[model samples]
Target chain A: MITHRVSLFVAVVIACAFLLFDRAEATIFERARQAAADALSPVFEVVSGPVSAVRDFLADIQGYLAVHEENARLRMENAELLAAQAQARDLRRRNERFAALLNVQVDPTIEYATGRVVADDGGPFRRTLVVNVGNNDGIGRGQAVVDEHGLVGRIVGTGGHSARILLVTDLNSRVPVYVEPGRRRAILSGDNSDMLRLEYLESDDGLLPGYEVVTTGEGGLIPPGIPVGIVAGELNGIWRVRSQTSFDSIDFVRVLRFDFPQQIEIPPPSLPGQFIGVEVTPSDSEIITTPPATTDDEPARNESDDTNVAQPPSEEG
Target chain B: MEAGYRRGLGSRIARGPAIMVPVLVTLLCVVATVMPYGSLQGIPLAPMFPLAAIYFFVLTRPTLMTPLGIFAIGLTQDLITGGPIGLWILVYEAAFVVTSMQRVFFVGRPAGEAWLGFIFVVSLSAAIIWSLASMFYQTAIPLVPIIGQMMVTALVYPLLAWVFTFVLPEREGGA
Candidate 1:
């Protein structure tokens, strides 16, 4: 009994030491965490199989039940989308012409590696998920993860066969977002709740409930123009955003492989009357070049020049 | 000679289950706790199934689930959940020690009394974890999900206890 009591006391002390000393930013601890995750990835994958099968079965039944109403809704949505598609095409052509005339660079198309979520750390304190795609699948830390809906989270740690996603609703999550229609910039912060808080909005003018919010891509860690969520409501005088990506039903996700652009020096025009029409650098060309489509079996190659692949930006608060 | 050989083989087989069953069931509970139940909406947090197992084993077969074993289970949960490393360790260890101390009160009592004791354990665990996590993050963690998790864990404890008793009927009286 004494031995048992002493062991339990020692365990408590060890746990306290770990809690106090293990910093999240420590390299050793991070690697150890990722290694542990890799070791358990296969088990998580196997365990999630039956759960996925049951979910699919229930979904099929629900779909069958709601087939008629869903079909009608889809038909109406399709008709509206057809009209919107034509308008969008015309707008895209005009926008491209304007961009070329202005010499404004277009954002690169983001290629993503898809994976299934095998584990969900759903609790009050931290919100995260373990995805099956990892370093082997070209998934890296700081990559943005999205479901069929919109911005879900970003990769925080990666192992050989698994990666951890820090969800948007986590307390530590801070996303720089642009609130439309005014394009008002604000930091979307999470408080470990369903709704995300909008921090540092300069003016609330025209920032009503139901306004759209999206990534500004100011830091370049995340790609620009990914839909995040809509402004939900104001609480305690703080505006909140309802994430488009539903946390409850996140099954599969795509980890985007986006490389931020590096600064390039442009040379002066040598001869007189030489119209130096905005010297497009190599990086600019790389950004404009369309990458080949890749399937699940084929990982997309990083298209940026070796020297120009910028380091991931520091996380914003 | 044939009868003696059969007796030896039977003892060997029995020993295997005696050692492996509790650990396997506990591991299964850990896996079930973290499994992605995306379709199961309305409940935001998964119940602490492993905790239920710990409570049950600590009360019924204390020798099988040593302090070291419980610590390992807690570490596995922390690693899998991607939470703080020692968060669940402390929680589970505290639960183990407290449950072990109160084993006398629960040993021969009715199943309802054991369940009430489990409710106390779950509440204590929830308090410890919520406090530790809040302190670790340097912010006040929300209480709603913790309360929900506590309620779910307490509600499911009797079911797991029943299952354990049904599986290990002989050992049920060993506490």
Candidate 2:
């Protein structure tokens, strides 16, 4: 009996060590698991269909129950949205004109494939969801997944017809983000809670509550300017982000396709015409520092401010 | 080919439910854990169907619920749930090992005793799972959902036991 107990103990310890050591994200076991999941996805889809349908039916009934209040809210929102749309069109036109004046190439277009959420890891340990689109639909690992509101997560594993999305609320998620109005950079990390924590901020610089946070694309993984969340609150020096996307009722999601540029180096000037007061790198094209150094500290600060406001239309070699 | 022999073969075939019931119930429990149930809409409401089923079989039909079968069920769950491979295997095996050791104590016990035993075993199982998961993720997962899962499993244990026994009766000549 003692030997049997010792053997079981040894077996469990060995299993734990094996799993801990086999920590590679992409492994043969993971591939086999993905294949198994792909094979069983049809069953999951069939099962989830009725559940989602019933949820929709219930939601519709609730909508009818609160129809009057909802109509009032929708009408108010529509009026605000109409005004915002006109303002956005004007800004877009201005942006296009500026791009033409600066001889800037068109911004890379973002393409997307839509899919339905079929299942979630129903345990307390992780926040992951399986969507019905996979590599067959241009869904690849590390592609951003978003809902209508904002960024939701990224694809971590892909099968033939299904993919797993590791939600931004998962403990493993880390997104480099830019806090708007101030442009303070920070890392948004999840701890399996409703709110995400802002980490890696420089000392003594704090973000105000409700400040907008968007993806900075510093890692070149997620595209820049995708809205992530707002600073909801802070506790014990950790700022929390209230993600714009609602994970509770996530039914459909869009997988964004963004190809990161290969070469970031700028070639040296070949001619005087190509030489300008600014230099451009493919990785961060928006930022341009003055080519010449000024000994006057005040003037240099002023020029830097001006550079931020209006990117001088100078060609770079 | 004799008439009496043919009659015995037919009787054995008629006892197919007796042979298939435990395995089918266990597999169904595994499937139901990952099934999209509406009541499990929000919050990490893990499906504890397997816990209840395992508890029932461990108490009533220990021989039918072998260690290898338990291990297979746990591994399947881990693979499908997309969690660390050995997590559920460890949890399920711990539960099985503990219960199998105490199976004799549960024999011929009253329903209350069985329920009490389930409560104790599930709490131990939940603690083991919580610690192992926390270790795997390198952070402490919240305890609320694990506690909720344990409570729900314990509350539903009697129902599962009743169903199991009803489906597979304890005849006077039972194994």
Candidate 3:
């Protein structure tokens, strides 16, 4: 009896000591945490591989069972998507022309690499997942991760061959977003739940249920206009985001290398009789004799020339 | 003769299933945690199988399952799950100490009594873990999920306890 009590007391002391030490040298402790994760990832992979295979097999069986219903749903979705695609193409062409007219370059084009989700932070306290790609694949801190649907999260920590993603539903995640159609800006924060809380809305102006929410790129951390989710329910003045990405079965994800737009540059205006799109350089006589046609829609030659030289205002407002 | 008996007994234990069985079963419980079981609204419903195993072994065979072994199990769980470190270690060790102190009432009792005791222990364990998590994260986590996990862990205790007893039958001499 005495021995048992002594051992129990000793164990309690040791546990408390670990907690104290953890709080004292948090950096060293975090390094140890990373090391431990790196060591255990291989074991997790070996165990989860067969389990994932079984799950895939079971999902396949369930898919076959719902084949007819799924086919009908897909057919309906495909039609709508095709129509949307055609409209999107036309809008994109117009957007490009507008961009060229203003001489404002588009946001830096993002590149991506794929990775497999090998392990997850299975505890309810944290919402993080470990993927099999890391610095080797050019995945670094703050890179956005997404699936076919929408944003999952961003990279928080990286190991050599693995990286940790803070899911959008984690307590620490705060994404600046714009509520579309109205374009009201808000912060999408996670509280370790399925739904994310939308905060900091200027007045909830034009905000409603089912309003589209996308990243605003306010801090230049995430690229603007990536679809996040729609505005969801409200309780006690807290609004939620119904994320488009399915967290239950995130098997593969793309890590986007999104470099936020830094600065805007505008070129000097072309000389009269030197059309912007025309390839040929006109001779001196052609320049002297040709008339300057500055219509009302197009400002006079002097002002329009200065307008082309001036940089457009920043997109923050 | 005493020395010879001691040596023979030690060698017998080394060759026996005492160490490997409990450790392997506990390790299996750890692996069961990360298995790809379906979840409830994104929260996994897999019962805390390791907690069940720990309660059973700590109650049944305290001598074989040492405090260090318990610490290792909890630390491994914390590490793999990416939770705040020392969280499970503290919980598991506390459970170990509580069960060990109350072993007299629990040991060799009817299965129903064991299950009942497990309900109490796991509920207490869940409370400790939840409170620790809330403190660590400095926010009040919803209690619904914690309660859900506790109920599931308690419900699965009987099946896992039966497995433990079936695999390793009671010996003539006990801890």
Candidate 4:
């Protein structure tokens, strides 16, 4: 009877594991995962501080020694930036009004919480970071994270004082984006590299290299128009976005304080019963454009459909 | 007599579950999980605790790595990796099965043999994971990184094995 019970126990464990894998619904395990993260994140926070301090101490030493050359370079760049800022101010007045006329609600005000990157997942299989800002600092999950250049990632997990930023290179990273005025829709998926792969592009979208990719704000997860990356490479029919933010070079990061416009309606969360589409909810006050759905008989809208469609202003709050 | 008792207790303490496996596996996972820029960092280091533990068990005490333990480790990797659900569990299960069959080769084998066996295991482990992941995602994964990581895992294998020897007897049960 004991042997039989052990057999039953093993069988039950395996059965529960395999049976619990309901593809469509959120797994019982997802809750467990969140709980586990909550429990362990505190410990992780404690553990990571010393590691980050060591890195910072070393980096400071390096930066201190290179200060002169760096200062000279920064001076030259500052002058150029000043000149550009003047030019941008002139253009902004004309563009802002034109944007206003177009009823384009470009993101006007953005607040940021500067956070030091405490820990990084530098493994072969995953890429992520623990940032110092969390719920206490008003950092919300799904906020856009950026550095000096542009898009870094979206925050996925939040703790009391620290949050995990899922970088663009993580395997699970995906953002909805529309190519400039034409608004070609594609999913940007991260595959553990500096370059994110643009998957599920419509055939004949004419996505030439060097075209800019921006958030479409279709999903309230990210706002539109914060520079993402240029279409860096198209090899073997695969297009990749060379992220504007140097993911590898991130030291300190800023979490944008933006809320999803609560206007966009989303599908209600259904219990995990069977296979279901991920519930895509548009945060209200978020107006987003979508490509017309494809039908079998309809030839997909040509590339011209996306051409001349001006992108909306998007920056993570 | 006291010294003899102390030695016995010391070995027992060394073999304690709370001290050994968790330390090894968690250290590896934590380091690997927090490893930023594995591809860009020319250091060629990827945390290899899972490989390390599997090798230690397969070579020393195959029974230690039960299916449930392997499953748990794989599940941990899945959660940490943020990949599709059943991925790492399946790969780990496959590794566990393969390791069981190859247990004899390492018995009385030199450290070099153990090293070779680890290279074999880590290579096979990487290949299985890479190929299965491609099938799952239906996308071509860059094989070079996996291969590169596997080599690093192999290089680090000896040191970890050396560490394990301080606890797990070089000759099984010799303690």
Candidate 5:
């Protein structure tokens, strides 16, 4: 009895020490976590195989039960989409022309690697998933993960054969987004709930329920224009976003492989007085014109020229 | 003399299963709890099967499950769930200590009394885990999911305890 009590006390003390002392940013702990995930991912895959099959079977039965209503809904949606598709084609042409004229730099095409979700966080407080693709498949930290519906989450950790994704609904997740109709920028913050809280919006003007929200790509890590969710409603005087991605139905996901463009430096042109060894000899019949300078205009002209010449370096810096 | 020898051999044979069954069952429960059951994903929580198993074995065969063994089980769960390292460990150990201290009150009582005792154990374990997790994340986590999980585990305890009884050795004068 005495030994049992001693053992319990020792275990409790050690556990407390680990909780208090172990930092989340420690590389050793991260490596160990990834190693464990790598070792256990296959076991999760095997266990989840039968469970996934059963779930799919039940889903198929539900689909069959609702086939008639689903068909009617699809037919109406198809008609609407066909009309929208034509309008979209015209808009695409106009957008391309405008972009070419403006010389706007557009994002490159996104490439992705697909993987299966092998495990869930299983606990109530955290929302995460372990997928079977990892660094070997070009999955890296901060890459955006999406299902067919919309943006699901982003990769946070990876091993050789598996990776962990922090879902957008987790308390730690914060995504910069633009609310449409007014393009009001806000931070989509998760509160470990089904819906996300829209924080940091500057104004509520022109913002309404069901307004579309998309990523602004403010952070180059996530590319712009990915469909995230819509403004669902307000709760406790705070706006919320309901994610387009359904958590329960997520199985396979695509991890986007994108790299932000780097800035290139341009050398500045030499000032007129700094030119080396260029003697200007006018031809006998050629006339060189010089403007009649006014005392009031001379300094202003020189200052404006200097300002124009100095703008690039400061902007680049 | 031959009959006495046979009785001694039979007692020795019973000892191995008596110890191994509970541990194996508890480990199985740990794995099952962590498996991705998509159907249950909508519920926002999974039943704490390992906690229920530990509670049962600690009540029936307290010597079989040591603190170290319980610690390992908790660590496995924490690692698999990708939560804080020692979160479940502290929660499970606290429940074990409390249950062990109070085992005498429910040992020879009716199944109803044991079931009632288990409700208290599950509630205590959930509260400890909820508090620790909230502190770990530096936020007050929503109470609905943990409360829902507590109710689910308590409600499911009787069924699990019944299944466990099939593996347990019968008492000399059975309750």
Candidate 6:
């Protein structure tokens, strides 16, 4: 008798779930569900705060203490970089002049909307992030996100005040990437790992395990040449692109206000509203100097008053 | 407060709101505290609190452990952790079903037996969850870390079970 009842109940649930799946979005039930989600999300955030604080305290304490050592190492590396910069500078000048000679008018001019990562959507199945900048910040759907390291992901959905970025390790994520220096094309697919698989590549490309992959700029989802990672160890002879940007524990990020088919509008200054405060640092060189501290009570950023005097007019060389 | 307090003496975990509520809150808090999210590089210790709670409740009072209630709790986990919407629901159902079936075996057994059962159940549940997630993701994700999580969960079962033992102090005529 119990078995019979259980089967019937299971059958009903399966039927209902199937119906829900078929309708997809725009259904009354879906709206109600999303509405409930929207309402409850803030409450969830409140509950998650203690955990976040503890995590932040641990990650930051050790990280900040070691920053001085990292800085010294970086400074020494920067000195070496300065010496090499002269050689790279000449090469860039020649490359730029050559590009000018070629009349490279149609280069993929990147227009980026800088934003800060507010929350880490760190579960196993879903690897995403909540950026402070959103629709109000001219953050639209399908904009490519990149960090200093390389390609993070593209925007899947946007709230009014914030947007959710689907990282390269998410199940739903896919980017058309090319094995660079080889000109071989393949789709970089996410399967909930730090490394993403390179799928659907032509066999003739002679792809190796350690080949570098980058966005092909094919679907306009991502700009080309944003370093996707080196090909990690292959599985069943299929290579995967390990993303350069470890969005693993990143606390801040930038979202590019990119659009395709020409005419891209980078977000203007003063884009942020009162809801989310993002530190729009003008340069990367100053993050170590000070990127203001944010508490749970208030979001962090360098106060405009303190930072305004630094850059008025540059001494044009 | 009630739950933690009652398990020590002549009180019933089921009858005391103090014990039950605190247990629920503690379960939630413990799960929240050391949650492993993100990629495999830094998965937290996974002795899942809800799994422990569900086991205790079903073993003690099956009526108290409602499917919809468990489903709702799992929903909260999914939303907060940014997992697939129905993923935890399926996982909870699987766990619930197994516990419901095996609950009879746990009655009259000492706390240690329950703890062992919990470890076994948690490992089984983690395996199912890992497999289901892998299937949904369409890849053979590594089992090493997942195995580690399950092992951690099993090891932590006794502590959490001890906490549960307080809330639902199993005794004759307690129900």
| Among all candidates shown, the one with the greatest TM-score | 1
Chain B TM, per prediction: 0.83, 0.81, 0.87, 0.75, 0.83, 0.75
Q: Which residue ranges in model 1 land beyond 4 Å of their true spot?
A: A24-27, A56-93, A269-317, B1-17, B39-45, B166-175
Which scores better on TM-score, 1 or 5? 1
Assess candidate 1 and give its TM-score to the true structure. 0.81
Candidate 6 per-residue lDDT, tens place, B1-175, comes to 6775466444444456643453365346434532323233634333566777777777876655656556666655555444455566667667777888788888888888887787778778877778766765457766655666567667777787677665664333544
Error of 5 at A192 (Å): 1.4
Candidate 3 global lDDT: 0.71
TM-score against native, each model: 0.81, 0.78, 0.78, 0.68, 0.79, 0.66
lDDT of each: 0.76, 0.71, 0.71, 0.62, 0.75, 0.59
Residue A191 local lDDT, model 2 = 77
Instruction: Give candidate 6 regions above 4 Å deviation.
Output: A1-37, A40-91, A102-123, A130-136, A202-212, A232-236, A262-317, B1-47, B78-85, B134-142, B162-175
- Specify the CAPRI tier of model 5: acceptable
Q: Name the candidate, 1 or 3, with the larger lDDT value.
A: 1
B-chain TM-score, candidate 1: 0.83
Consecutive 10-residue window with the lowest summed lDDT within model 5 chain B? B37-46
State the iRMSD of every prediction, in order shown: 2.2, 3.1, 2.2, 4.9, 2.0, 5.2
> In model 4, which regions exceed 4 Å deviation?
A1-22, A49-87, A96-108, A112-126, A132-137, A159-162, A178-187, A198-211, A263-317, B1-38, B41-44, B63-65, B138-140, B167-174
Q: lDDT score, residue A284, model 2?
A: 37
Best by lDDT: 1
lDDT string for model 6 (A1-317, tens) is 36434743574375346334523432223333333334444544555456446656766775798899979978976895787689779979999997666543445466677765545543334566666666777887677788887888777666556666778766667776668557776777776567688777755355666567877655444555677787766777767666657554555567776554432222223443211112343441223233222111111121232231122222233
Q: Estimate candidate 3's RMSD in Å.
A: 10.4
| Candidate 3 lDDT, A250-298, residue by residue in tens | 7889999876443223222433323233333333222212232211111
Q: Quote model 6's TM-score.
A: 0.66
Looking at model 1, residue A220 earns an lDDT score of 54
Segments of candidate 2 deviating more than 4 angstroms? A1-14, A24-28, A54-94, A202-206, A264-268, A271-317, B1-24, B36-42, B162-175
Q: Give the TM-score of chain B in candidate 3.
A: 0.87
Model 3 DockQ class: acceptable
> In terms of TM-score, which candidate is stronger, 4 or 6?
4
Question: Model 1 over residues A9-101: C-alpha lDDT tens digits?
Answer: 888888888787765443446777788789988998998888877766776787799899989978976896798789879989999998776
Compose the digit string of candidate 5's lDDT tens values, residues B2-80.
Answer: 9976875676476657556777788778767766655343454457888899999999988678898888887777776
